[model samples]
Target: MEKESGSMKSSSQTRTEGSKEFEFTARDFERVRALIYKKAGIALAESKQEMVYSRLARRLRATGISSFVTYLDRLEQGSGETEEWEAFTNALTTNLTSFFRESHHFPILAEHLKKVKEPIEIWCSAASTGEEPYSIAMTACEAFNTLTPPVRIIATDIDTNVLNTGANGVYSIDRLDKMSPERARRFFLRGKGAREGQVRVRPELRQMISFKQVNLLADNWGVSGPFDVIFCRNVMIYFDKPTQGKILDRFAPLMKPDGLLFAGHSENFLYVCDEFKLRGKTVYELDPDRKTSSAKLRRA
Candidate 1:
């Protein structure tokens, strides 16, 4: 009884540090930011400190805590506040991705799939709310000229709520406004009544992809993959150097030797000299046989 009480007291002290005004300091933001980067490969700026705090503030309030200091303390102390951690990570992480968000990338995907010889597997690492992955699937259907069993997509996200929504493959009308008219008509089913003007991705596209909850930081990945392509766009900016390296190292084995990797326009391989070889400006080719090098690259 005494030992358990002491442990509880120590936990309380740790949490108290976070709950105090001192807990939400610049240093605390940096600590949380670094942890997020390490865990999710999310790159965030100090300017986002307020965003993190404010978003988390609402969550803390929802949890019946009024002060960030107390909230920070609860977060740090693990005072049975696992929901707080999930809320923190979910709110801080960006999910700005959309269906065919970067329309330009689809042609690249089509071109790559045209060359794949084996069972084609694609991983949409930042597949948010299912749009992107669904787009990939529909693109595959277009690429192959038919829906075949061989084409598959694995879409993963850190947020369960979004994962559920993605798996549902539903979206509002406004979000669908950007989709090309032909694609929109073919791909979306118009909802009515309470969901009037909203849309859901057609079952054909939704069926081709599998959705799962994944945190990039957790160990082992519990996945066996040798993908033909990995769409890891817009995900690496949140991570620092070492975290980026570790993720790439893990990413390499999941990709085939000649597999293609696509990243967001904002990300680059300029600083990452190892793990993956540059295939093009926004794409990489995993070359495990080649040692990591600072090799000059020009498109063939």
Candidate 2:
């Protein structure tokens, strides 16, 4: 018993303090590759085997692990490996988000939200760093002030790191440069001198949005929503056709009638037949709302 305890303690110590020249065995690559794909739909090519190791190298070093295999073992054994997985996902997942990233959609949103003249509920399906949701809030501030209820934004992201940033509601000035000066002045409060040049979205606007974790591919979303608008922008491009189609199919029931769906500029109903009308790239009004048969989108 004493010998077993001693050996375990030594193992834990070494695992906590990792070594240099971390070697990721083929088995490690296989395990992580499938894990990423299964969870996030990120398909890693054979060439990317070293890319994972290279990216994880910094993480291993930060945790004092010098060898890839050692850090890999640490990941398997550590109680906090969930956070490590988040770090890995953040490193690997493409985060191409910015405020008002695809400007075209905002005017449509403004017009639609204003037209509804009802309690507004919007979803930023891949809210990322909260910029997209904040942009939505700002647009609402300018567009729907006279409405009976202010806009309600639900900002969700699978990436916990970005969601945490989103919850913080603070961002660099550069992130806000694309925002209109008047809107920026109205919605953003400048960070103090020590944190100079940084800006934080006003609490009123930030409070209007709820940030939560949601894996779109999961069996159950655990979200209570049939959102009036779903801005699932830029997140679907990583998926293959079957995956994209299935996602849209599943997402339809989660939307309200007359609600709009916004995909990224690069995504569309090209092969995603049946459920949507080809209103335009990045825009699809829910088919059920189409008063005319002509509004129905065709299979390509």
Candidate 3:
């Protein structure tokens, strides 16, 4: 009776595991977690197993690979950079952004822009689909009361796919529903005829930003700074505390003494790095006591 019961339990477990098109064992999930962490500094939680499977399953089908093992092996064994690797990273990347996301930050940013007399340099560290950077540009324009603000924004992301979308500067008109109609009309050109239901950002806003592919985990971010503002919102939550500290340390040298760092609503930089102090809400400024000469010199 005991042996029969054990066999039935094993059979039930097998049926459960077999429900999906792909065989995803716990070990496969661990491998994915480790690889993504190494590649992108993203610390995937255990709860993400199903999400990973769902996303990668499409990659597996697209590549005509029969199993996760084979698909992962191809990625692991590949030399240097490959299209598949890019696809893999892009697939796993979660891009949830909208025009003027974290709306409160924009008002603070506008206030800061007004205080600075010099031409401004801003870095939108995760420019996903271009909305954030364009919003920044729009804010700058409004602060200065002109279509052309003396601001240059470097918008970058690790996912080249999204970088391409950002550079295109086109989106469905509905994406603008939250903005005041005047703001929307001022910033976007409505599509007509064949392109109905879409809107393109004004050329001035698009021109203010330069899009690039940047991996925060990389030794070199491929962009220089002395930036007045760095918008690193929502991107750090994916990284472990140590990775977040290292990135914050790197950010310190690249910013002016009075420069501001904008973090996500839930992110608190106070515990992560000592270089910055809370300025307001999620905004951070260089710690007065820890100000470095490089930062001061950068401003001069």
Candidate 4:
């Protein structure tokens, strides 16, 4: 009992040194920012310290660690380090998304499909929770007016938890609030009995997508592509310019020369990447001239 009491006191001292509520310091915040940038290419801002503390504080408590520093140390040099890193990466990833987000893009996608005579391949590089990829499937169906459209979509993200959610293809009924009633009736089935207040994507739509956990910053994506279109939306805001440039460089090799790239409303890639030219609202087309220039530069 005496030894247990001493151990309890030591734990209390450790917590007091880096108290749960207010002990996250500037240095600690910088360390976290650096680590996340290195691991995931997410360039967190100084303003995000509170968010980091709130998100990671739960981790420290779950691990029974007293302070952020100690938790970080354990993360850096510990058994099960891979799992811990996955947890850390998952904790920091922001996965805010909704069905048919940026509705204008769908019409453009439909038109683009009309011009293609062959099978089309697409990549949704930041398909959070499955909404965007499923939306792509829906648009393809609408464009082709068929149950089994010839569109192949690869939807990927770094969060395994969300990938599972996306793969399951089930969502709360409230998720359909923003979607049109016709679309809701067409693409999703209302759950019944024990599954009330939920909906599942119809098998037709689910089969159109292949969901996987992919970290965009990783060395190899393992995805063979000459994709006709790539949807990488609302993700560049979290990365620095150099990281964004590197991603674009990698994307150039995976896309066909005439392929389209759709971006989020707030992301403007005009200055970040020269290989894609702004074609329309938040839409980019591969720049033939820049492609030639890149080839020349590589040879030189």
Candidate 5:
């Protein structure tokens, strides 16, 4: 699915002006691009200069640092407060998600559920705001025809702020506007009186998922795998080919032989990774012919 990076103005022209609150130069933006890539594996484009300035400016304001260079120097030197790095990373990360985004994938997942054994494990690799993982939980419920399905979903994201939101499992009522009224009534508890227009996911759905902060680029993701399904949708587009390949290599080892990998509608893993073969629309399964470690382990 195409990600929307809301309206942006070019930073090229803004560089010539002197009206900005913070002194954000081309080099500052470059430093940010480098640091984030090293820390999180995101490849920021030159066109994102404007977006960078706007997002990081809030950090400057919060930290009471008047200049981008000084703030960046602190981060680069690792002298800033321990939480500042978390804050900086959070400021730059973009999260755009809705319930059952890429609707086609959910039905595919539902069918896959029937074929798999009980006590299935799923990893929602980019569980922004909990919508995607909750959708998975809901799908599991529907597949088994029960509110308490034999499923466990581990929802992860790099941004701690969103992970916290997801763990809360609350959202504005409008987020479910597109869903069938029956589905909405079954899965969510509507807010009343003072809490009207807000809804919280049913406890059963919340219990099915565990939200955590995970940096995909790290040597250790801190999550044990061999997951039956891994939903890494709309995430690879943020990475360059090399980073994408590395992540995919890591993914293969953590998956069961027949486990399915669901990617974004727009992502194509066919050329980037040899461990998997395209199984359906942006869906991938371990390539039996590839002789990857995971496949070999499964056969052995």
Candidate 6:
């Protein structure tokens, strides 16, 4: 039976009689694509048309706008633009990550920690929902055999929503599946009573991290670096080569001489940037000589 009360459900959300579907034209899509790229360095392909329509349709509903064209007009005319733009960018951003998603990198990080006798600072450039930064904290704790290990992590992302989540340091119990039980016990506190089946990052682990919302394409990252390790994984795949190269160039000066840069498995910087040499699988270090390291150069 159809509901008697009307709600602002998206038109494309479901198929029903007499409900007007939002008109999304090719011109509208192109306009949106252009706007997104200009605001954020993300390149949206033609195939993302449906996705664009679906994501923005909800925005239309919320704003009580009838069509995509009207919304686009409002957005471009600079009327209540700041909040709309923030919503637009947040809606389009993609963040998929898990605890120890790239399992191998953690061990390498641990080894890097062991070798570095001085203080260590790490920048997690795509900290989606806190797992990656918390994992870094756990690894540091294990490597140093202390809760108060001397390490600092700056976790940043363009999405304000996810940064808030990361700062909260809370997760469903199942988020720990990929992690070993021992490590989970060490770093997370299991919730009780009303919060059962959830875990929160232990105070010690939370203390090591600072979460912030940062757009990587911006002129200033707002965080001091010269970091020992930078986890910029699974983020560059969305950008074109030129954008990737520029970001890499910006990253080079912010890291130590032997600092490590971790890339996504699908990302290969060999063709894009000369500032970093591939030190291991998806791992890179600054290459002052600009000579590409051979694949035979094994991981330490």
What is the RMSD of candidate 5?
Answer: 6.5
- Estimate the TM-score of every prediction: 0.82, 0.80, 0.94, 0.89, 0.92, 0.88
Off by over 4 Å in 6: 1-20, 290-300
Write model 5 residue lDDT over 48-117, tens digit each, in one string.
9999999999998998999999999999898446699999889888899999899989899999999988
**Per-residue alpha-carbon lDDT of model 3 for 1-300, expressed as tens digits?**
999999999999999888999998899999999889999999999999999999999999998999999888888888465688889889899999999999999999999999976789999998888899999999999999999999999999999989999999989999998999999999999999998999999998889999999999998788788889999989999999999999998888888778999999999889989889999999999998887643544211
Q: Evaluate residue 273 in candidate 4 and report its C-alpha lDDT on the 0 to 100 scale.
A: 84
lDDT minimum window of 10 residues, candidate 1: 291-300
Candidate 3's error at 84, in angstroms? 1.4
The collision pairs in model 5 are 1-265
In model 1, what are the clashing residue pairs, if there are any? 15-73, 18-72, 18-73, 19-69, 19-70, 19-73, 42-238, 43-237, 43-238, 233-264
Ranking by lDDT: 3, 5, 4, 6, 2, 1
- TM-score, cand. 1 vs. native: 0.82
Worst 10 residues of 5 by lDDT: 1-10
Indicate the residue-level lDDT of 42 in model 2: 66
Candidate 1: stretches off by over 4 Å: 1-31, 34-43, 79-81, 288-300
Q: Which numbered prediction scores highest in TM-score against the true structure?
A: 3
- The alpha-carbon deviation from the true structure for residue 165 of candidate 2, after best TM-score superposition, in angstroms, is 1.1
- What is the alpha-carbon lDDT of model 1 when measured against the actual structure? 0.75
- Model 2 global lDDT (CA atoms, 0 to 1): 0.76
All-Cα superposition RMSD per candidate: 10.2, 10.0, 2.4, 7.2, 6.5, 7.5
lDDT of each: 0.75, 0.76, 0.91, 0.87, 0.90, 0.85
Write out the backbone clash pairs for model 3.
none
Q: In model 4, which residue pairs have backbone atoms overlapping below 3 Å? A: none
Model 2: per-residue Cα lDDT at residue 95: 68
Sequence-dependent TM-score of model 2? 0.80
lDDT of model 2 at residue 74? 62
